[model samples]
Target: MIAARKSLDGLSAGLMLILCACWGMQQVAIKIAAPGVGTILQTGVRSLIAALLVAALMLLRGTAFFGRDATLWPGVAAGLLFALEFLCVAVGLNHTTASHMVVFLYTAPIFTVLGLHWLVPGEHLRLGQWLGILIAFGGIGLAFSAGFEEHGSTSTLIGDGLGILAGVLWAATTILIRRSSLSEAAPTKTLLYQLGVSALVVLPLAAAMGQFGAVSMTPVIWASMVFQSVVVTFASYLAWFWILRRYLASRVSVFSFLTPLFGVGFGVLLLNETVGVRFATGAALVLGGIVLVNVKRSPQPVPV
Candidate 1:
């Protein structure tokens, strides 16, 4: 657990950046691994592993998953929303290119900032912060708009709509976590509920969709699953919840614009995707917006 601090302190900023990077890399990894393991099923498989890991951690920490004190309604809500977010992305990608998915999925922060500001106390974004959000999102759009223009035929309105729905579900997830009783529970236990529910719900749906594709049973695949289970789901999510609790959700949400930039960076390195001047210029605007938004609140001068 992290010590108490003001919103978006140095540690919090560093942690958010790292998590954004992991999520960025994860987009590439899941795309590469999706076909063989099955897109939605792969999420379930790693979710199950992450659930087991969280369950074990819960036992050690004495955070019960099934005791009378369990937060049933909130946990279930979060899990379903979590499941829906990924399901939408997986299914949406079938109808759209990864560009559409990338652009749509990260629109989550906009929804998150709006919803949290309305619902949660101490979670409001100032006008400047809101401006930063818009600027950063615009930069993301500018950075990736080239792809949309270049391969416009590959994306469908239906697919883009589905991806937007996923972004809404993601916003719903954050709002639910903040407003629901799950917020009162330990981070690991909340994580367990989400993964357990996702494994149960998504696995059956994948089976129904005939998405249980044959596995190569390769060592590399197993390693990838292990990495997703451990790094992506377990550690990264725990860090997110911890950070969320430590800071205002709206303040934190703006920084998430970095994820797509990191995604593009890794895509260029790993997939040999070309980066044009738009990408570089957009990346600078995004980073500048992040720094602008998180600029420390001016110290109030108190006088007698």
Candidate 2:
């Protein structure tokens, strides 16, 4: 049993790492498609496609997609938060540098820690964790300062702010998932709620933003949309929720640090963006802080 448990833990860690890598690549994919598609259109198409693919997968796997309990409300709330997060990201990307936007989006973990402390009474960060959060936030500030100096536009600043807002929304969604009765629901049903709510929310917003007409039938655009929907958004999220349901959220969340690192690397490789000392230094600090925040220490028993 010990060996089997160890193996399962190793596999779970591996899966989480892959998920992070894929998420990192997703930033690159979005950047690639951004030039051709409006942000709203990109988000809407990706959500729509992902929802369809997830529906299909559920059908194939014989898993019931809808939750049968009061948890449904929390699931719906999570989905709304997911939609809001993406909407902010999409609109914000239009106004900001991709590098800056990526960095700002990582602030989600900070928000997560804060939210968890407030909503989940038993979970609290130690002083060391608080220090780590500060260090990580400082790193984010440094990255923002450097990126803003190099590529700052007014629109970019707006987008960067939006990205931060998106992170807050994401954190809220996570906290809701943990604190609400939805914690006991099936992962698939929970995920389906998130996607469905996001799709519903984004469709009208995208349409109102005049992104509908911007949609093209081009093979490249379609391919990017489909990949974002099926691979990154749908499959990746399914795997993520599955892990979250089975594992500790804090430990799993630490892997998110890799997303921005991968985003920076991909930006350099694919978009030909410059990778400088500032970016590297900031990234190291951010990743280090993430590690510090995530490391678990044994809690002391209360005095009898």
Candidate 3:
């Protein structure tokens, strides 16, 4: 049994790492796809595809897509928040560079930590945690400042602002999931709710923006969409929710610091974006802060 548990632990860690990589690559994929498709259309199609993938997975796993005990309103709310998050992110990408957007989006964790503290008592951060958050936020400021200096434009500022809003929405969604009764819902079902909701919200907006006509039936676009929908959104999200269910939220949330790191690296490689000193310095501080916030201390035993 002990050996089995050890193997399971190792497998979970491996899965988490893969999820992290996929998530990192996902930012790059979306950035690549942005040129061919309008942001809203990209988000709508991705959500629709992800919803379908999750549905297929549920079928294969013999799991129901709808939960018996889950409240419809909570699911709907979660889905709405998810949609807003994606919408903001997609639109922000159009205005800002991927490197800038990625760093700003990571501010979600900071929001999550704050929201959890208020919504879920006993989840509050200590002084050390607050210091860590400040450090991480400073990193975010640094990244933004670097981007602004590199591309001094009104549109870039707008994009950066949108990116920050997206982070807030992302954090709100996380809090909703953590605090809502929907926490008991099956992972597949919850994912479907989020994806389906986003698709519903964005599809009409994309149509209104005349993005449907902009979509080309190219192999590259199709490939990017498939990766975003099936692999990153569906698979990684399912795994993320599963991890949230099984572990402490703080513990799992801390690993998200890797997203920006991966995002910057991919931006350099795929988008040929130059990494500046400010970006490096800020990312280091942010990641260091996240580590400081999440470090676990050994428990002291009580005297019998």
Candidate 4:
């Protein structure tokens, strides 16, 4: 009963660019607020705030959460993975620059493609996609080698590894959704499951890690929380789901590669983080690979 989805248009493209910018800025926001609030606490609190907003939205939409659908197990699994992903993000950022963290995290698409190729029928990779995978890993190696050059700092390397692990977890979540009843559930429902479960998981984890007492909650930190909870987590996700419903997902996915670029830019502008020439070159390859991995080949017309 769904309408046929269309290719990306002008408005959607612009909105996607805006969305990418918001997503890119997310790491920088976390970094900015980290001085006042520990990263785990920040992530947990924001998830809690956004979960409330999403619940309110569901209430207004009259969407029932406890349906007869078989999404519960998959949803819980996805939520656990989501918690782990952000846990990596929160811990990893303590050791790496926001720019580096963003680049590494956005590698999720490559991992997702690889995972789908293995798990899902009819999702095999083409030559271009294979090339993309190789290029992206090559870039990862190049960037990771930078940590070796630092001689005394293994923390950055550890952070980068966590970032890649987060990407893998994110891909796993996507595959789980695609392979389960959550694929048919309302997008809001899926999102709420992730957010609600993440809040429950991370809050306790943060407390166990002794991350709660660090909260200083300055005006800037509060603003960062608002931006993260309201704008980035709540509004941006809803916009992304709306876009997916309306546009060709493959084409729409291609633009997501821009997120790291925007993230790097925001890190430079706001956080004053430096991007070395070596890292810049590697990030370029990673972005290029991600684009190739997501872009589908257009079919040729047969000659009469």
Question: In each prediction, how many residue pairs overlap at the backbone (N, C-alpha, C within less than 3 A)?
Answer: 0, 3, 0, 0
Best by TM-score: 1
lDDT of 3 at 192: 90
Q: Is candidate 1 or candidate 4 better by lDDT?
A: 1
lDDT of 3: 0.76
Model 4 segments more than 4 A misplaced = 1-12, 132-152, 243-254, 275-304
What TM-score does structure 4 among the candidates reach? 0.84
Pairs clashing within candidate 4: none
| lDDT string, candidate 4, 1-304, tens digits | 3334455667987898899999999999999999899999998998999999999999999999888898888989988999999999999999877766776787787777667667754456678877877786667556545544653268887887888888788778877876677756888888899999999999998899888977788899899999999999899987876775555443455457678778877877987756577767877886777666656454322111
Model 1 TM-score is: 0.91
**CA RMSD, predictions in order:** 3.9, 4.2, 4.6, 4.4
Error of 2 at 162 (Å): 0.7
Where model 3 places Cα greater than 4 Å from the true spot, the runs are 1-16, 298-304
Summarize candidate 1's per-residue lDDT along 48-138 as a digit string, tens digits: 9889888888888876667665588789889999998888887777777665676788899899988977886656667787778878888
* Structural similarity to truth (TM-score) of each candidate: 0.91, 0.87, 0.88, 0.84
* C-alpha lDDT score of every prediction, in listed order: 0.79, 0.73, 0.76, 0.78
Q: Which residue pairs clash in candidate 2?
A: 95-155, 95-156, 96-156
Model 3: lDDT of residue 216? 61
Full candidate order by lDDT, most accurate first:
1, 4, 3, 2
Residue 293, candidate 2: C-alpha displacement in angstroms: 2.2
Residue 241 miss distance in model 4 (angstroms): 3.5
| The best candidate in terms of lDDT | 1
